[model samples]
Target: MDEVAAAIADPVRRHILTMLRDESLSAGDIATRFAISRPAVSRHLRVLRESGLVRDELVGRKRIYRLDPGPLAPLAEWLAGLAGGDRWERRLDALETEIYRTRRERRARGPVEHRREHTA
Candidate 1:
């Protein structure tokens, strides 16, 4: 669990996971999408690969990465399994409700005004 948490804590790594959520990407392709240095991207990928959240295959000298949902399944199940599977579900519900409320409030607020009033 600690390993999974640590891996997910990196924002770039999270974005990498997002990129690979439904499709695989080449190493070069992944590097180009982010503003970070290629070496930095490689390092991040290395950490993610080690964390078991991603897998890579070498094809014709180019390495391709894909999300491996298998390892993450255990984490999801563990969270859901806590408190007999109700805790995680309740937390998810709370999050969804909060998101809906926030959207509603934002829509109510409408556009923002940036002018500052002059003080005498």
Candidate 2:
């Protein structure tokens, strides 16, 4: 997970992953899309490949890269918990505590009788 996080920390690598998400592209194809040098793109690809975020195959003389999202599951799940589940749980627990405190305060205050004043 740490490897995947580190690999995606660079905007270049993230863009590469986004590109590969749709279709596989050869190393040359990817490099051409970026303003950076081919060697720089190759290094980013190597980091992604090592992290298992992408898989590559040598077809003929060209190396093709594709997104492999399986390894991202753990990271995605962790992010999901942070964004949704755990946050909601904390909010609901806070709400419940507030509700209990309000109820206790109301009980302590006792019921009040309504009184009307007539215009003189």
lDDT of each: 0.87, 0.91
Tell me the tens digit of each residue's lDDT in model 1 across 21-81.
9789999999999998999999999988998999999999899999987777777888768
Q: Which regions of candidate 1 are displaced past 4 Å? A: 81-120
**Residue 72's lDDT in candidate 1:** 77
RMSD of each candidate? Answer: 14.3, 6.7
The RMSD (Cα, Å) of candidate 2 is 6.7
Q: C-alpha displacement of 14 in model 2, angstroms?
A: 0.4
RMSD over all Cα atoms, model 1: 14.3
The clash tally of candidate 2 reads 0
Scored by Cα lDDT, where does model 1 land? 0.87
How close is every model to the real structure, measured as TM-score?
0.65, 0.71
lDDT of 2 by residue, 40-114 (tens): 999999999999999999999999999999989999998897779888899999999999998887777665511
Badly placed stretches (over 4 Å) of model 2 are: 86-120
